[model samples]
Target: MAFSQIKVLPTTPLEKLGRVGTNDVYIQKEGSQYTFFYKNIENKEDESIRNFSFKNVENDFENFYKIIIDGFNANPIYDIKLELPNDYVWLHYTKTTSKLGVQFMTTNKVTQSTGISQIMSVEDVKKLFEKI
Candidate 1:
Protein backbone atom coordinates (compact mmCIF):
# COMPACT_ATOMS: atom_id res chain seq x y z
CA MET A 1 0.00 0.00 0.00
CA ALA A 2 1.05 3.54 -0.67
CA PHE A 3 1.26 6.37 1.88
CA SER A 4 -2.04 7.70 0.64
CA GLN A 5 -3.75 4.44 1.54
CA ILE A 6 -3.70 5.26 5.23
CA LYS A 7 -7.17 5.95 6.55
CA VAL A 8 -6.36 7.84 9.71
CA LEU A 9 -5.87 11.00 7.70
CA PRO A 10 -5.41 14.65 8.57
CA THR A 11 -8.87 16.05 9.25
CA THR A 12 -8.73 18.70 6.46
CA PRO A 13 -7.55 22.18 5.47
CA LEU A 14 -3.83 21.57 5.35
CA GLU A 15 -1.27 24.35 5.08
CA LYS A 16 1.88 22.73 3.75
CA LEU A 17 4.84 24.29 5.53
CA GLY A 18 7.52 22.63 3.45
CA ARG A 19 9.42 19.38 3.01
CA VAL A 20 12.08 17.98 5.26
CA GLY A 21 13.44 14.94 3.50
CA THR A 22 10.54 12.66 2.60
CA ASN A 23 8.16 14.17 5.13
CA ASP A 24 6.05 17.20 4.30
CA VAL A 25 5.75 19.79 7.02
CA TYR A 26 2.20 20.96 7.44
CA ILE A 27 -0.16 22.93 9.60
CA GLN A 28 -3.46 21.13 9.48
CA LYS A 29 -6.80 20.86 11.17
CA GLU A 30 -7.41 17.73 13.18
CA GLY A 31 -10.95 17.75 14.49
CA SER A 32 -11.41 21.13 16.20
CA GLN A 33 -7.78 22.09 16.70
CA TYR A 34 -5.13 23.27 14.30
CA THR A 35 -1.80 21.43 14.48
CA PHE A 36 1.67 21.44 13.03
CA PHE A 37 2.96 18.06 11.86
CA TYR A 38 5.26 16.08 9.67
CA LYS A 39 3.33 13.89 7.26
CA ASN A 40 4.72 11.03 5.25
CA ILE A 41 4.24 7.48 4.17
CA GLU A 42 5.04 5.14 7.03
CA ASN A 43 4.78 1.38 6.67
CA LYS A 44 4.17 1.12 10.41
CA GLU A 45 0.56 0.84 11.51
CA ASP A 46 0.69 4.02 13.49
CA GLU A 47 -1.59 7.01 13.24
CA SER A 48 -1.14 8.92 9.98
CA ILE A 49 -0.33 12.38 11.32
CA ARG A 50 2.64 13.29 13.54
CA ASN A 51 1.47 16.45 15.29
CA PHE A 52 3.63 19.02 17.11
CA SER A 53 2.38 21.13 20.00
CA PHE A 54 3.08 24.57 18.57
CA LYS A 55 1.23 27.49 20.10
CA ASN A 56 2.45 29.63 17.21
CA VAL A 57 3.53 27.67 14.20
CA GLU A 58 6.15 30.15 13.04
CA ASN A 59 7.70 31.08 16.38
CA ASP A 60 7.36 27.72 18.05
CA PHE A 61 8.73 25.80 15.13
CA GLU A 62 11.57 28.29 14.72
CA ASN A 63 12.50 27.90 18.39
CA PHE A 64 12.51 24.12 18.19
CA TYR A 65 14.30 24.17 14.85
CA LYS A 66 17.06 26.27 16.36
CA ILE A 67 17.45 23.78 19.19
CA ILE A 68 17.56 20.89 16.76
CA ILE A 69 19.96 22.57 14.37
CA ASP A 70 22.07 23.77 17.24
CA GLY A 71 22.38 20.25 18.54
CA PHE A 72 23.74 19.19 15.18
CA ASN A 73 26.18 22.08 15.14
CA ALA A 74 27.48 21.25 18.64
CA ASN A 75 28.55 17.71 17.68
CA PRO A 76 27.51 16.34 14.33
CA ILE A 77 28.41 12.76 15.20
CA TYR A 78 26.28 12.41 18.29
CA ASP A 79 22.71 11.20 17.89
CA ILE A 80 20.32 13.54 19.67
CA LYS A 81 16.97 12.62 21.17
CA LEU A 82 14.66 15.42 22.23
CA GLU A 83 11.36 14.90 23.98
CA LEU A 84 9.01 17.53 22.65
CA PRO A 85 6.84 19.72 24.86
CA ASN A 86 4.06 17.34 23.98
CA ASP A 87 5.43 14.51 26.06
CA TYR A 88 4.15 11.87 23.70
CA VAL A 89 6.26 13.04 20.79
CA TRP A 90 10.01 13.13 20.21
CA LEU A 91 12.48 14.33 17.59
CA HIS A 92 15.43 12.05 16.98
CA TYR A 93 18.33 13.45 14.99
CA THR A 94 21.03 11.32 13.48
CA LYS A 95 23.92 12.61 11.45
CA THR A 96 25.57 10.95 8.47
CA THR A 97 28.43 12.50 6.59
CA SER A 98 27.24 16.07 6.02
CA LYS A 99 23.54 15.26 6.03
CA LEU A 100 20.99 14.91 8.81
CA GLY A 101 18.38 12.25 9.40
CA VAL A 102 15.32 13.26 11.40
CA GLN A 103 12.56 11.09 12.71
CA PHE A 104 9.38 12.09 14.48
CA MET A 105 8.21 9.58 17.04
CA THR A 106 5.07 9.18 19.08
CA THR A 107 4.64 6.94 22.08
CA ASN A 108 2.00 5.74 24.47
CA LYS A 109 2.03 3.33 27.39
CA VAL A 110 1.74 0.34 25.12
CA THR A 111 3.37 1.18 21.80
CA GLN A 112 5.56 3.61 19.88
CA SER A 113 5.43 4.58 16.22
CA THR A 114 7.66 6.73 14.04
CA GLY A 115 7.60 8.89 10.92
CA ILE A 116 10.98 9.21 9.25
CA SER A 117 11.84 12.36 7.36
CA GLN A 118 14.19 12.41 4.40
CA ILE A 119 17.91 12.74 4.97
CA MET A 120 18.94 16.30 4.10
CA SER A 121 21.76 18.76 4.44
CA VAL A 122 21.77 21.14 7.40
CA GLU A 123 21.31 24.07 5.04
CA ASP A 124 18.36 22.40 3.36
CA VAL A 125 16.77 21.62 6.70
CA LYS A 126 17.11 25.23 7.72
CA LYS A 127 15.46 26.34 4.50
CA LEU A 128 12.56 23.99 5.18
CA PHE A 129 11.82 25.56 8.54
CA GLU A 130 12.34 29.08 7.28
CA LYS A 131 9.24 28.69 5.14
CA ILE A 132 7.02 28.25 8.19
Candidate 2:
Protein backbone atom coordinates (compact mmCIF):
# COMPACT_ATOMS: atom_id res chain seq x y z
CA MET A 1 0.00 0.00 0.00
CA ALA A 2 1.11 3.56 -0.68
CA PHE A 3 1.04 5.21 2.71
CA SER A 4 1.69 8.92 2.78
CA GLN A 5 3.85 10.64 5.33
CA ILE A 6 1.62 11.12 8.35
CA LYS A 7 1.24 14.62 9.80
CA VAL A 8 0.29 15.31 13.38
CA LEU A 9 -1.38 18.57 14.23
CA PRO A 10 -2.50 20.25 17.40
CA THR A 11 -6.04 19.71 18.62
CA THR A 12 -7.85 22.08 16.36
CA PRO A 13 -11.56 22.66 16.61
CA LEU A 14 -13.60 20.18 14.59
CA GLU A 15 -15.30 22.91 12.60
CA LYS A 16 -12.02 24.66 11.78
CA LEU A 17 -10.66 21.38 10.47
CA GLY A 18 -13.78 21.05 8.25
CA ARG A 19 -14.88 18.03 10.22
CA VAL A 20 -18.13 17.11 11.91
CA GLY A 21 -18.40 14.90 14.95
CA THR A 22 -20.27 11.68 14.46
CA ASN A 23 -21.59 9.36 17.17
CA ASP A 24 -17.82 8.89 17.46
CA VAL A 25 -14.80 9.00 15.15
CA TYR A 26 -14.80 12.49 13.69
CA ILE A 27 -13.16 12.36 10.29
CA GLN A 28 -12.69 14.53 7.22
CA LYS A 29 -11.47 13.27 3.90
CA GLU A 30 -9.87 15.62 1.43
CA GLY A 31 -8.97 13.90 -1.78
CA SER A 32 -6.75 10.98 -0.87
CA GLN A 33 -5.87 12.39 2.54
CA TYR A 34 -7.79 12.00 5.77
CA THR A 35 -7.89 13.92 9.03
CA PHE A 36 -9.06 11.94 12.03
CA PHE A 37 -10.15 13.28 15.39
CA TYR A 38 -9.24 10.68 17.98
CA LYS A 39 -10.77 11.62 21.28
CA ASN A 40 -10.46 10.15 24.74
CA ILE A 41 -13.94 9.10 25.72
CA GLU A 42 -12.77 8.45 29.26
CA ASN A 43 -11.75 12.05 29.73
CA LYS A 44 -13.19 14.78 27.59
CA GLU A 45 -10.57 17.19 28.93
CA ASP A 46 -7.75 14.95 27.76
CA GLU A 47 -5.71 16.70 25.10
CA SER A 48 -3.29 13.85 24.72
CA ILE A 49 -5.19 12.38 21.81
CA ARG A 50 -4.31 14.91 19.16
CA ASN A 51 -5.69 15.12 15.67
CA PHE A 52 -3.64 13.48 12.93
CA SER A 53 -3.67 13.27 9.15
CA PHE A 54 -2.35 10.87 6.58
CA LYS A 55 -2.21 11.09 2.82
CA ASN A 56 -2.24 8.57 0.00
CA VAL A 57 -3.51 5.80 2.20
CA GLU A 58 -5.18 2.66 1.01
CA ASN A 59 -8.71 1.59 1.89
CA ASP A 60 -7.43 -1.06 4.25
CA PHE A 61 -5.45 1.43 6.29
CA GLU A 62 -8.37 3.80 6.52
CA ASN A 63 -10.72 1.04 7.53
CA PHE A 64 -8.40 -0.21 10.23
CA TYR A 65 -7.94 3.25 11.61
CA LYS A 66 -11.67 3.71 11.76
CA ILE A 67 -12.06 0.43 13.57
CA ILE A 68 -9.54 1.50 16.15
CA ILE A 69 -11.22 4.85 16.61
CA ASP A 70 -14.59 3.20 17.02
CA GLY A 71 -13.14 0.80 19.51
CA PHE A 72 -11.77 3.68 21.53
CA ASN A 73 -15.12 5.37 21.44
CA ALA A 74 -16.99 2.36 22.73
CA ASN A 75 -14.58 1.07 25.37
CA PRO A 76 -12.08 2.32 27.88
CA ILE A 77 -8.35 1.96 27.21
CA TYR A 78 -8.11 -1.37 28.97
CA ASP A 79 -11.11 -2.72 27.10
CA ILE A 80 -9.92 -1.76 23.63
CA LYS A 81 -8.49 -4.60 21.60
CA LEU A 82 -7.24 -4.19 18.06
CA GLU A 83 -7.03 -7.18 15.75
CA LEU A 84 -4.41 -6.25 13.22
CA PRO A 85 -3.48 -8.01 10.05
CA ASN A 86 -0.25 -9.87 9.87
CA ASP A 87 2.76 -7.55 9.59
CA TYR A 88 0.55 -4.50 9.80
CA VAL A 89 1.41 -1.85 12.36
CA TRP A 90 -0.29 1.29 13.57
CA LEU A 91 0.24 4.24 15.90
CA HIS A 92 -1.84 5.19 18.90
CA TYR A 93 -1.69 7.75 21.65
CA THR A 94 -0.94 6.63 25.15
CA LYS A 95 -4.00 6.91 27.37
CA THR A 96 -2.34 8.59 30.31
CA THR A 97 0.25 10.80 28.61
CA SER A 98 -1.21 11.29 25.14
CA LYS A 99 2.22 10.47 23.77
CA LEU A 100 2.49 8.56 20.53
CA GLY A 101 3.11 4.83 20.68
CA VAL A 102 3.30 1.84 18.31
CA GLN A 103 1.27 -1.38 18.49
CA PHE A 104 1.85 -4.78 16.98
CA MET A 105 1.85 -8.38 18.09
CA THR A 106 4.63 -10.78 17.17
CA THR A 107 4.13 -14.47 16.54
CA ASN A 108 5.47 -15.36 19.95
CA LYS A 109 3.74 -12.88 22.23
CA VAL A 110 2.02 -9.54 22.63
CA THR A 111 4.35 -6.83 23.83
CA GLN A 112 1.97 -4.77 25.97
CA SER A 113 -1.54 -4.87 27.29
CA THR A 114 -2.48 -1.94 25.14
CA GLY A 115 0.02 -3.01 22.54
CA ILE A 116 1.69 0.33 23.00
CA SER A 117 5.36 1.20 22.97
CA GLN A 118 7.05 3.87 25.06
CA ILE A 119 5.46 7.25 24.60
CA MET A 120 7.06 9.37 21.90
CA SER A 121 6.48 12.58 19.99
CA VAL A 122 4.39 12.76 16.84
CA GLU A 123 7.51 13.12 14.70
CA ASP A 124 8.92 9.94 16.18
CA VAL A 125 5.64 8.20 15.46
CA LYS A 126 5.87 9.29 11.82
CA LYS A 127 9.43 8.08 11.52
CA LEU A 128 8.49 4.69 12.97
CA PHE A 129 5.53 4.38 10.63
CA GLU A 130 7.74 5.18 7.68
CA LYS A 131 10.25 2.59 8.72
CA ILE A 132 7.53 -0.04 8.86
Best by TM-score: 1
- The per-prediction CA RMSD against the true structure, in angstroms, equals 9.4, 15.2
Name the top lDDT candidate: 1
- Residue-level error in angstroms, candidate 1, position 81: 3.7
Candidate 2 per-residue C-alpha lDDT over 23-85 given as tens digits, one digit per residue, 9 for 90 to 100: 123445566555444433333454333334455446754465455445444434433343333
Cα lDDT for residue 77, candidate 1: 49
Candidate 2 whole-model C-alpha lDDT, 0 to 1: 0.39
Query: Would you list the C-alpha lDDT of every candidate in the order shown?
Result: 0.55, 0.39
The 10-residue segment with the lowest total lDDT in model 2: 105-114
Stretches of candidate 2 exceeding 4 Å from the true structure: 1-24, 41-49, 60-132
Which pairs clash (backbone N, Cα, C closer than 3 Å) in model 1? 21-118, 22-118
